[model samples]
Target chain A: MQIVFLLEQVVNGLVLGGYYLLIALGLSLIFSVGGIVNLSHGAFYALGAYVFVQLSGTLGFTAAVAVSPIVVALLGILFERFILRRFYNEDPILSLLVTFGLALVAEQAIRMIWGAAPLPATLPSEIRGSVIVGNMLFSKYRLLMLLVIAVALGGIWLLLNRTSFGRVVRAGIQDPDMVAALGIRLQPYLTTVVMLGVGLAALGGAMFAPITTVHPAMGSEILTIAFVVVIIGGLGSFWGVVLAAVLVGVTRGVTIYFAPAASEASMYVLMFLVLLLRPRGLLGESIAKFES
Target chain B: MKTYQTSRLAGQKSVLTRRTALKLAGGTFAASTLGAPALVRAQTGPIRIGHLTPMTGFLGTLGGWAVEGAQLAAKEINAAGGAAGRQIELMSEDSINPENGATKAQRMLERDGVDFLLGEISSATSLAISEVAARNEKLFVAVGPRSDVLRGERCSRYMFCTDIPNTAMVNAVGTSLKQDGMVDGKKFFTLTADYVFGHDLLAAAKSFFDANNAELIGDELIATDVTDFSPFILKVRQANPDVVCLNLAGNQVTNFVKQYAEFGLPYPMVGFNLNTADAWAAGVGNLSGTWPTVWLDSVETPESQAFVERFKAEYGKIPENHAWISYIAVQIVAKAIEETGSAATPELIDYLESGAKFDIMKARQAYFRPEDHQLIQEAYAFTVKDEGTYDDVYSMLQLDGAVPAPDAPLESIYPSVEGGACKF
Candidate 1:
C-alpha cells in the first residue's frame, strides 16, 4: 500500500479517536467520582444530537451546538439530584439497573418525539470539503473536529490537575468519606460531576450530528464501543482512556484498510486480550472499584 | 380522558361531514334513494385500506415515507372523484415489533374493518402480518420487504408484493456483470449482515457467481449493529478478491463503503440492491463509482421521468426505487379497486389476479402475473456518481433485460395456493 494511503487512514483513525475520547472520558468521569455507571450516558448523547438537530433548523448550527448541551446538562443534573442521588448508598448493581432503566426511558422518549427515521444533519458550508496533507486527502471537518477534541482534552486535563475543585474531585475519587469529613459538600459535587460528564457526552453527540445521521438508537449503538474502549484503557484513568481510544481507532482504521470483513470484531478482540492479561485493564490501579 | 373523547368525536364529525358532502355533490346517492337493501347489495361503503407499519423504532423512517407515499396517492384518487365512486379511508397502526404486527393487523381487520391491507417494510414483520391477513381473508399489498420467500415458500394467494424480490435483483446485477465480462475469472468475497434478508441476498449472489464460472474466495457474516468493521476489512484484503459484494443496508452500507475506500482496495466493489438514490445520497461522497443493481432509475422510461419530476416536486428529494415501489403500490391498489367496481376484499383480490396492467416507473405496462402475483417489469443497473449534491448521486446505465417474467417462471417459485401455510 502507498504511504499516502496509510497517512489517510491515520487521519481517519484520529478523527474516530476524537469521538471515542469524548465518550470514554465522560464514562470515566461518571465512574470515578460518582461511583455510578451511567449506562444512560449514550441515551443522553442521542438526546443531545436530536436536540441539536431540532434547534439547528431554527437557531442555526453554531447556536444549537452551543445551547443544546446546556439543556441536556441541566436534564442530567435533574436526573442525578432526583433519581441517581437516591441510589448513592445502595449497591452499585442497583445503580446500574436504575441507569439501564433510565436509558430505556430516554430511548422511548426519543422515539416518541422524533419517530424512527434517521434525520439528516447538514454540515456547515464553511467546513464542507477535503484538505490535502502531503499526498493524502482528509476531510476538512474531520480534521477540525480532531483539533477541537484536542483542545477540549487539554482543558479537561487542566481542570482535573490545576483547580481547587479539581483537587476536591480527585480527593473524593480516592476517598469520599475523607473528603466529606473535610467539610466539602459531596452531594453537590457529585451532581455537578454527573452533569459535567453527561454534558461532555452531549457535546460529543452534538458534534457528531453532522457526521452521522441523528437517530434515537444511535446512542446505544455507540455506547457499546465506548464501554469496550473504557475496559481496554483502564476504567477511571483519563490519560489511559485517551491512549486506549487511539489504539482502538487506529486498529479499526488499519484493519479496515487491510481486511474490511474483520474490522467490526477487532475492538472486541483487543478488549478480550486486555482483560485476559490485565484484569483491571492497562492503567487500572489496584483498587476494588465497581465494574462498568 | 375528556380531551381524548373530544378529539375522537371531532374525527368522527369530519368523517360524517366528508360523507355528507360527497352525497350532496353526487346527486341523491343510490343508497339513500334505493333504500338499505340496495346499500347492502351494491357494496357502497367507502373502501377501507389498512396500513400496518413501524411508526416507531429503527425502521420507522422508511415507514413514515411509505405512509406519505400511500397518503399522497389516496389524496390524488380522492380528489379525482374517488375510485368506483367510493372514497378510500386509510387506517394506519404501528407494527414495530413482531407480535405487534399481528396485533395491529387484527385491529385493522376486526376493529377498523379494513377491506384490504398495505404495509410492512421488514421481512420478519411482513411474514408475521401475512399470517394475520391470511387468517382474516384480507388482500395484502407488500410495499418494501424484498425477501424471496414472500413469493416463494411462504407465498399466499392473498399476499402480493410491490417490492422486487432479492433473487431478481441479484440476477439483474449478475447478468450485467456477465455481459460486461467483469465476472470472468474473478475471485468473489462476500461480507454480509447476519440476518434473514442479508443471508438470503448472499445466497442468491453466490448462486449467480456459480453460474457465471466465478470463484468464491472468502465470506464472512458479521452481526448486525457491528460498529467497527476494520478487522473484517483486513480479512477481505488478505483474501484478495477481485470483486467484493456488500449485502448491507442503511448506515452499515455507508460505514462499510467509507472504510473500503480508506483501505484503498485495488479491486472494484459491486453492491447488490444498494443502488437506491436515497442510500447513495446518504453515503455522501463515499459511494462514488460503485455500481449496484436496481429495477428503476430516472433514465429508464417516460413514466419514470414523470415520477422523478413529480416526486422531486412533492418531497424535495429524488424518489429511490423503494419510493417508486410504494408509489406504484398505491396506484395498483386503486386501479384494481376501480376495475372490480367494488372494494370488497374478495373482489379486489380477484381484480388483482385478473392481470391488470400497471403504469410503473420503467415498465411501459407492467402487470401482475396471475399465477404468482409478482409484477413483471424491466430492471435497471445504476452507478453512483459524485455530483456534489444529494439530489444527483446516481446515474443510470441501461442494460439488457436481466430476467423477464415470462422466462423466470415465477409460478414455479410460489407455493401452491391450496395448502401453503404462511411462514414467519
Candidate 2:
C-alpha cells in the first residue's frame, strides 16, 4: 500500500510537472530567446483559462481548448508589437515594470469582463471521471492533459531544434546583433517567439481549465510556479525548465505525504540550494552580463 | 432726436422681456433640483451603515450575497420608516485586502460618517475592520470570517460577530457527525489551509476528535493560494482515513470539494466553515457530507423561509448563508438602534451587549453574549440530499440537525471565553 501510494505521488507529480512545463517553456523561451522577462505571461495564462470558459460554452470543450491558446497568441502578438517593443532596447527594469503593469491590467480586465467569481468549467462527459491505471485511480481529464502536454513539449522541441526558424531563434538568443548582421529580420521572429511563448502559457491554461477553477488570480498563482520551473531548469535552457518542473512537482507531491506544510517550502528550499550552488541554474550556460 | 428716443425705448423693452424669461426659467429649475435632493436627504439622512466586505477576490461571491442581504434589510427598514425614525443608508466599499479594508473602513467611519459598519469575509480583512471599530469606538457587525479568536482573546467591545465562530462550527458539525456515528474509531485525515482561520478550525476539530477517541491519521496545512488539491487527495487515499476533514476556506474549499468528487474518493467528508457559495460554485454533484452552516436556504424555521423567499425575490436566487448572516446582523443592530432610539456607537454597543435576544433566522432567538459580543445562535448541520434530479438547486440541502447554544453561554458550542477550541 505504501509503495503504491508513493508511486501514485510520482504519477500525480509527473502530470502536474508536465502541466507546469508547458507554461514554463513559453516563459523560458521568451526570456532566453526574446530576451524579455514578459511578466504578464501569467496574465495570458489567465486569459486563456477565461477564454476557454466562454468559448467552451459556445464551441464545446475541445474546440475551445484548441482555440483559446490561439486567441492568447494573437493577443500576445499585439502586446509585443504595441507595448513590449518600446522597452526592448532599454534597461531590462523598464520591461519588467511594463510587463508588471500589463499583468495588473490583465487582472483588472478579467475582473471587469468575467467578475471576480471562479466560473465552473467542466470536462466533456467522456473525460469527466477517473480511469484505472494498474490498480491506481487517475483522473481521465488529467491523463488527457498529460498526453496533450507531451505532444506540445515534443512539438516545441522540434520547432526549436529541427526547423530553420529554430536556428535563427537560437542564434538570436546567443547574439541578436549577429543574427541581424546576417540580414535576419529580428522583429518578426522576436514577435513570433513572444506569441508562441504566451500561446504555450495559454495552452496550459486552456488544458488545465477543466481541472483548475478559472479565477482571475489563477494566472498570478501559476505565475510563481512557472517562474520557479524556469529558474530551476536554468534560464534559457529549454530542457532545464522541463526537468525542473518535474523535480519540483515530484518533490512537492512526495512532501504532501510526509510534510504537506513543507511541500511548497521544500520546492523553495530546493530553489535556494540550487541558486547557492549554481546561480545560472542546473543547465544554464555561461552567465553573460545583462546588456541594456 | 425723435428717431434716437424711439430706438432706445425699443431696446429697453427687448432687454426687459429677456430678463423676465431668464428669471422664470432659473427660479423653476432651482426649485425642482433643490427640492428633489432635499427630499432625498430627508428620506435617507439619519443612519448610514458602511458595508466593508470583499466584493472581489476569492470571497467576492460570498460578499455579494452579504451585500444583497444587508441592502435588503436597509431597503425594508427604510420602507417601514427606518431605525429610530431615521432612514438607514448603506455605503459599501469592496474590502479587497486587509490594508484596503482598514483604509476604506477608516475612510467610511471618519470621512463618510457611517453610523455603523458591517460585513467582511477574510479573517485578516475582518480583523482589520474590527480593529478600526475598536479604535474609532464604532459598532461593526462582522458577517463573515468565523475565527473564534476574533471574539475571544482579541474580543472587541464594539464588534459583533454574526457568523458562527470556528469553535461553534466545529463543535456543531463534530457533535452532529459523531451522533450520526461518523467519529468513533475513525481515523480522519485533515487538509487545512495554512492561515489563521484554518489553524483555528484544525484546533477546534482536534478537540472533537480527542473527545470522541477518533484517531487522526495525519493533517496538512496547505497554503491558501494553492488551487491544486491532487497531492493532498492522494495523501488521504494513502492514509486510508475513514473521514477526510476539510479545514479549508473560500474558493479553496470549492476546488477541493469538486476535485474530491472528481477523484471519486471513498472517504466521507466533513468540514467546518463551508459556505453555501462554495457548494454552488462547485455545483451539485460535487458537494457531499454533513457540514455546519450559520444558515441555509432549506432551514425549516419560518423566519428562515421568509428570508429565503424575500432574498430570492430580490436577488433572483436563494439566500446563501452569508446573506442570511448579513440579514440577521442588520436586523440585530437595527433592533438595538430602534430600542435605544440612537445610532450612537456606545449606546448601541451597550444595548447589544446587554444580552438583547432576537430571532436570527434560527429555531429560537439568539443573543449577543456581553462577555465576547459573539451572537449565541443555533447553527444547522447540512447534508446534500441526493434527490435523483438536480433541478431544484436551492432545495437540495437537508438540515441534518441543529446545534443549540447551551444554557450557560460559556459552554455553548463557542470556545471558553478564556480557552478557545471546539472539536468537530
Candidate 3:
C-alpha cells in the first residue's frame, strides 16, 4: 500500500515536471540558439497567464489557452527585434543584465495594468474534479494539462528534429559563424526561436493559471524552478532538460511524501548532486560559440 | 538647475573660479545652518510614519491592500486638518523579507527621520521589525501580523500587535467546527506553513484539538514558496483523515484552495488562518469550508461599510482585512498623537497602553491589552457560500456573527494569560 502511494506521488510529479518543462524548454532553446540567457522568459510566462485570464473572461477557457501563447509570441517578436537582436554575439553578461532589467519592468507593468491583487481563475466546470483509478486520485484538470503538454512536447521535438528549420536551428546552436559564412542569415531564425521559446513559456503560464495564483511576480516565482531544470538538464540539450524536469518534479514529490518541509529545497539538492557529478549538466552539449 | 550648476562647476578649473566657488559654498552653508533651527521651532512639518510590509513575495498581495488602506486613512487624516494640526508624511516601502524589514526599519528611524513605524503582514518580518523598533525605542504599530509570539515570549515593549493572534483564530473557527459536530473524536490532518506564523498556528491548533478530544493524525510543514500542493494533497488522501485543516498563510492558502478543489478531495477543508484577499483570490467555487478572519468586508457596521465603499471607490475593488486593519491602525496612531499632543515615542506608547478605546470600524471599540500590547477586539468565522449562490468571488464568503457574541467580552475568544512570557 505504501509503495503504491509513493508511486502515485511519482506519477503526479511527472505531470508537474511536464509543466516545468514548458517554461524551461523555451529558456534552453533561446540560450542554445541565441547564446542569450533570456531572463525575461519568465516575463513572457507571466504575460501568458495574464493574457489568458483577460481573454478567458471573453474568449472562454479553451480559446484563451490556445491564443494566449500566440499573442505573447507576437510580443516576443518585438522583444527579439528591438532588444535581444543587438545583444546577440555580444557579451553574455550584457544580455543577462538587459533581460533581468526587462523582467523587472515587465513585472511592474503587469502590476500597473492588473493591480497587485491576484486575479481569480478556475478550471472550467467540466474539468473541475478529480479522476480516480485503482485507488489513485488524480486531478482531471492536471491530467488534461499533461495531455496538452505532451502534444506540445512532441510537436516541439518534431519541429527541431524532423524539419529543415530544425536543421538550421541545430546548426545555428553549434556554429553561428559557420552558418553566417554559409550565407544563412540567422537573424530571422533567432527571432523565430525566441518567439517559440517565449510562446512555450506563455503556454505553461496559461495552463497553470487555473491551478495557481495569477499574480505579477508569479513569473519570478517560476523562473527559479525553470533555471534549476535548465541547469540540471545541461545547456543546449533538449532531452537533458526533459530528464531534469522529471527528476526535479519527482524528487520534490517524493520528498514531500517523506519530508514535506524540504520539498522546495529538494530540487536545489538535486542540482547540487548533478553538478557535482556532471559540471556541464546531465546531457549538456559542448557548443562552439559559448566555449569561445 | 542643480545638475547644470554642478556641470558648470566641474567645467571651471581656474584659480579664480575655485575661489568664487568656495566662497559661494561657504555663504550658502552658513545661511542654511542658520535657517534650519527656525524651521524646526515652528512645529508645522508633516508627521512622518514609516510603513513597511512584504510587497513582493507570497504576502505581497495583502501588503498591496495594506498600502492602499493606510494611504486612504492617511489621506483622510491629512484632509481632516491633520493629526494635532500636523500633516502626515507617509513613508511606505517593501519590507521584502525579515532581514530587509529590520534594515529598512532602522533606516526609517536613523536616516529617513520617520516619527514612528507601522505595518507588516509576515509574522517573521514583523518580529524582525519589532526588534529594530525596540533597539531604537520607537513605537511600532504592527498592522497585520498575527503570530502569538509577537504578543508572547518574543513581544517587545515598543511593538503593539493589531491583528488577533493564532489562539484567537483557532478558537474562532474551532468553535464553529464544534458547533457543527466536526470536532470531537474526529481524525485531523493539517498542512501548515513552515514559518513562525504557521508553527504558532499549529501549536494553537494542537492545543485546541487536545482539549476538544480530536486527534491530529498527521501534519505536514509546507514551505512558503511552494505553489503546488498536489503531493501534499495526495498525502492527505492517503491518511484518510476525517477533516483536513490548513495553517497555511498568504498565497499558500489560495493556491491550496484552488488545487484542493481541483483534486476534489473528500475530506472537509477548514483552516485556522485566512486573509480576505487570499480567500477572494481563490476564486468562486474553489474555496469552501470554515475559516477565521480578523475582519471581513461584509461586516455591516456603518463605519466598516463606509470604509469599504470608499476603498472600492478608490481602488475599484473590495478591501481585504489587511486594508481594514491598516486603515484603523493609522487612525489609532493619529488619535494617540492627537490626545497625547505629541508624536514622541514614549508619550505615544504611554497613551496607547493607557487602555484608551479607539473605533476600529467594528461594533465594539478596540483597545490594547496592556499586558501583551495586543488589540482586544472582535473576530469572526466565515463559511464559503455554496456554488451558484454568490454572484462574485468577493461575495463567496458569508461571514458568521462576531465571535464571543455581541454581548460577550471582546477578549473572551482571546487566550487568557496563565504564566506571562511577555515582559516590558
Best by TM-score: 3
The candidate that achieves the highest lDDT relative to the unseen native structure: 3
TM-score for candidate 3 (chain B) = 0.91
Clashing pairs in 2: A233-A240, B174-B424, B204-B422, B208-B423
Docking class of 2: incorrect
Can you list each candidate's DockQ? 0.11, 0.20, 0.56
For candidate 2 chain B, which ten residues in a row score worst on lDDT? B415-424
The lDDT of each candidate is 0.72, 0.81, 0.92
Q: What is the TM-score of each candidate's chain B when compared with the real chain B?
A: 0.79, 0.85, 0.91
* Cα lDDT tens digits for candidate 1, A1-292: 6765765666667678888888888888888888788899899899888899899889998889878889899999899999999887777777887899889899888978876556656566466655556755565666777887898889888888899878988888877888889888888878888888888888888887766646677888889888988888887688889988988898787766666556778888899999999988888754433524
lDDT by residue for model 3 over A1-292, one digit each (tens)?
5898999999999999999999999999999998899888899999999999999989999999999999999999999999999998676777987999999999999999998999999887789888888878899999899999999999999999999999999999999889889999989999999999999999999999999999999999999999999999999999999999999999999998888877888999999999999999999999987774
lDDT by residue (B1-424, candidate 2, tens digit) is 3444444544443433545667776887666555545435633477888988887666776787788888999899889988888888888779998999999998787656677788898888888888898899888888788887787666677788878889888887887887789999989999887877888789888888898899988898888777778988877776789999899988888888878876777788888778887776675567778888888787787877887888878867677888878887788788988999888888988898788789776777888777777787788788887735555445567877578634544346777665432111
Ranking by DockQ: 3, 2, 1
Docking class of 1: incorrect
What lDDT tens digits, residue by residue, belong to model 3 across residues B1-424?
3444545544644444556777877887677556655447436688999999889899998899899999999999999999999998789899999999999999888766688999999999998999999899999999899999989899988999999999999999988999999999999999999999999999999999999999999999999999999999999999999999999999999999999999988899999999988988888889999999989999989988998899989888888899999998999999998998798899999999999999888888899999999999999999999989989897798898789788788888887755767877
Question: What's the ranking of the predictions by TM-score, best on top?
Answer: 3, 2, 1
Task: Name the regions of candidate 3 deviating beyond 4 angstroms.
Answer: B1-43
Clashes per candidate, residues 3 or more apart or on different chains: 21, 4, 0
